[model samples]
Target: MSKKISYEFLEGIQLPITVKKDILEINKESERLLFINKIFQIF
Candidate 1:
């Protein structure tokens, strides 16, 4: 799933992704969450 995300509260989060591959990238920098209100339709 290659979907772009835009939010309001992405400040300072942490992501220790050692094994990099095909994965959904999200900003984990501040107060905002990595995956919050996103819904996927795999119907």
Candidate 2:
């Protein structure tokens, strides 16, 4: 289902050695996605 796809897509990523700002942005976005996933599981 959609949930499994999202989970795997996130899991499949490999972090790059990059600028601090870029890393922070990616972390924030992933955290938001994780929060949304938790909400989906709750309902």
Candidate 3:
């Protein structure tokens, strides 16, 4: 369930863009990392 949501943000990462560029990719990667950290913290 959570993984599905994480993947949603990771998708379309290859599209050319004049947006935040690498920042957006880093943000998505960070989100996944934070989710992992939280899951680990629970144990």
The residue ranges of model 2 lying beyond 4 angstroms of the native Cα positions read: 1-27
Tens digits of per-residue lDDT for model 2 on 1-43? 2344444544565534342234334445556466546645986
The lDDT, on a scale of 0 to 1, for candidate 2 is 0.48
Candidate 2 clash figure, as a count: 0
lDDT of 3: 0.50
For residue 33, what is the lDDT in candidate 2? 64
User: Backbone clashes in each candidate structure, one number apiece?
Assistant: 7, 0, 0
Best model per lDDT:
3
**RMSD of every prediction:** 10.2, 10.6, 10.1
Error of 3 at 13 (Å): 24
As a TM-score, model 3 comes out at 0.38
On the 0 to 100 scale, the lDDT of residue 32 in model 3 is 60
The Cα RMSD of model 1 versus the native structure comes to 10.2
Candidate 1 per-residue lDDT, tens place, 1-43, comes to 2232323222222323331111234434221223332322221
Which scores higher on TM-score, 2 or 3?
A: 3
**Best-to-worst ranking by TM-score:** 3, 2, 1
lDDT of 2 at 29: 56
Runs of candidate 1 exceeding 4 Å displacement:
6-12, 19-22, 25-43
